[model samples]
Target: MKRFKHLLPVLLLLMSLTAAIISCKKGGDDPTPTPTPAQPVTTITSISPATAPVGSTIAIGGTNFGTSPTSNTVTIGGVVATIVSVTDTQIVVVVPTGAANGPVSVTAGGQTAQSQSTFTVYVAPLKPVVEISGTTFANQNWTRDKIYLLKGLVYIPADFTLTIEAGTVIKGAAPDQDPDKKNMAGTLIIERRAKIIAQGTASQPIVFTSAKAAGQRAYGDWGGLVLIGKAAMNTTSTAALPGGVRGTVERYAEFNDNSGTLRYVRIEYAGAAQPTGSATRLSGLSLYGVGNSTVIDHVQVSYSGSDSFAWFGGTANLKNLVAYRSFDDDWSADWGYVGNVQFGVAVRDPDVADQSGSNGLELENYDPTATTDVTPVVLANGLQQTAPVFANLSSFGFGTTPTTNKSAKGTGAYLAGLYLRRNAAVAVYNSLLYGYPEGVSLGATGATPGVTNNTIDLQGIVLANVLTPVVGNGVLTSDLTTTYFTTSGRANQIVQSSDLTALRLNNFNATTPGFLPQSGSSLLTGAVTGGKLANSFFTPTTFRGAFGTDDWTTGWTNFFPQNTDYDR
Candidate 1:
């Protein structure tokens, strides 16, 4: 009976265990189920030729490319991309044609791969090459599709010739704000030993002017025309041709006897400034220490703010130079310019001028310590004077600068007709000095040495309505010359006192005509050159005054006069 009881207990235990196992099995068999394989995601990875040409073939890379996308498809920009070929993990697409040289992108299966906006198609510019050989301009037809740039001190190779077609405009560049960088506008530096055969006739004369429009034109609009030659000039340095060529400013080593020729050419406003403190200020034409081998004839410099022509101590010969309405001194040569000039004229503006405005010529030696080697700048057959004497000198007297002394006169040394100071020794003859506050004042600074051996042989010279006598210590005149201290030619005259505190003179207006030499204006006939009169002064036969002849009035006009203010 006990064994039977133990067996029953065992059976009950076994049945309970079985019931627990069944419960666990029932819980495991609930409604939850595992998922089947999912559809793969589509995406774009990369593009080739990060920067490709417009017509180049490009490739696109990506994964899970669809055959016919319903909501998302591969595209570039907004245009749907044509899938040349597609695989399970990649898609090949050709770049679109006629695409701009800008950024490109690839979009596939709602994913995008982009190239930045700065990225562009690569295309090289076709540069026009110029090859000069055998001392002659060989590439005559090279400028067809090219622009010329005279970069970084270009040496006009010796025995090399540069011939440009008519009506060609060349711009200059110089580092203004930054000399180290490309700050300079442009510059054409004609170095020593280099010859340029730039010839222009009167009928079809060559023009060198600013690129700006007439109304907006200005002086120093661009860099100046720097001609470096081995010439003689009046300067303090014992060495000839003081300022050297290019960056080397020294005495001339070998005197170049080949005089550069410039005829029937008109250079408009030029004279762009270079680096700060640079001696260059953009004179219409800058002759840096050239020699007598240079010839400047039949050239017109109009509306230039600076001196029309600046010679830095060179022995160049000038014939028929016209200075029409230059703001500063008409002709400036210093540092030993021992050159000879004939048939030169200076014209002044009644208005639209500055205190620095001068009628005839100015010469000087900026250096105070250099040894003296004086060479006289000779001038003949010219009318060197201010316009007409305005009764009210207020309008014409140094027009603007209150501090400027209109009554001052000298060889540019003091202030007037022939100002020769800073030890500058110059000689002048057969020129008229009229309508000046002071005829001639010499030795500006008490310490500054006066002009030595300088002669002014004024034959039939007219001195009309001047503040002071034409015969100053600086002016050495003979009996043949007439000096009228108190005289009047064209009315409306004014005079200032020595105190220089008040303005004096009479009704000077815009309409007041300066000295206008008539066609038969006595000055037309009597010009004794070397000794014999030349038929061509500026045009046909020596005419009169500074601009003895007129080329524009005859058949041409519309010369782009330079602006008085080059910087503005």
Candidate 2:
């Protein structure tokens, strides 16, 4: 039994070894089974915003998009979309132009998948733009099919003409804030003997504005327009033309020179866009030696960073002029301007003013820096003092509450409705001045003969909500009230009333302003009877203000330009 037991242990160990060899066998008869390859899982689960305009970005959620953006190719509506970013499960892309309604597809790695839903693409309505720069040496015509973009200063040389069609839009390029870009602010200068025939209708007035996105436009976005001509100018002293344009006496200017016509035009953000960084200051519209043959009517200048309208030594006449939200003076006439203007309105902003004083009308004749005093006729230039005439003007200043002068100014000049200085020999009739520190200012610039010698006459002047009816330096209030304002023939009154009661304007909102006078308003009556209305230059009407029932600013004027999406 002992011998058999010993043999059984050896036989058990041998059987175990044989079984291990059999279990670990890797021979050809039992070769390893071939491994199966895994299938790719590239897919597009969902696409956000089934429909979008071209250039709009959208996101797509899926599986196996891969981490590398270069390996992913996304297409919307069969158009290849630019992949903005990519992740393993989501991809963001910008819709491509000319894309149509089709499935959103994404090809990742070696596999491609598409979203179940289709993506619709639409075209956004946009205005086509044309850029213009430098000088205009030849006659040019601007049409309405496209918007013209003015880049930097544009000059019209002598003998050239620029014809702007009705409903045409001219936009100034964005101010190149970089100091390296000098004189890059958009400006138009019509040199002497040059002409600009921009005659628009009331239904489709031409528009000049800033080329900026909506809500980003402001005063001084670009430079303004200037017109110079060979018109007669009587100046004994230095003249400050619009945008610092100077009047020369190299030759006698003709009185009958035809400058051009500008009617039914709206200028927005057209003024000194202060490029304190590099460029010169600008004005809304500057006329240097412009003659009476030039036609300017129904023109609105809004958001001017400098003077709205300035005429230096010329017999240029204008009617139906509107100055809104100007940062400086509205109407500035200097250096013997002997023209006639009627039906003008100036509305001031409560928040803005100029550093050189803000006034509705700033009239001057001679510069004190040039000469001490002047006679009517001077031998040097055969020049006389300023003697322009104006009627039916409305100047709305600060609110009834006293203004705190939010703006700065040199010369310590105060805010006034009318500023007459430096022997300004002129006349104003049937004018309305409202809401100002001084309704009529005189002698502030050391004037002597104009107010006292009866050269400067003001008749039918209606002042409402004015702090002071007549105020100036070195002038008695009683003398001004009794001599000029309270005469029997003149109908001048200083009353305290609101805009709704005195003018009854339809709308006075800052952005969308309306200056038409309605019924039950004081502006409907009390016009000059026979004094200046009998003149050929004046429109014979009983209305005391610029507007009477007829809304002159209805059709083409855009008061809400701040919210207008011009490029969209």
Error of 1 at 62 (Å): 80
286-365 in candidate 1: lDDT tens per residue? 77766666666667776665677887766566765666556566677665555566656554553434355464566666
List the global CA lDDT of all models: 0.46, 0.75
Q: Let me know the TM-score candidate 2 reaches against the reference structure.
A: 0.72
lDDT (10s digit) by residue, model 2, range 1-568:
9999879989999999998888787453776789998876988888887778876789999999878779999988888989998899999999986788999999988888988888878655776887887776799999887888887777788899999999888988755832237655777778888899999999888888988877899888888788887665665323333353333433445666677999999888977554343324677887877888999999999888778888877778899998888888889887677788998888877667776678889887756543323564242363656778889888887654546455443322337788877666668888888778777877623434555655677877887767666775544243664466677677887776544366675656776667777778777888776754566878887888677777677777776688665564
Q: In model 2, which residue pairs have backbone atoms overlapping below 3 Å?
A: 220-273, 355-408, 355-409
Give me the overall lDDT of model 2.
0.75
Q: Backbone clash tally for model 2?
A: 3
Top candidate, metric TM-score: 2
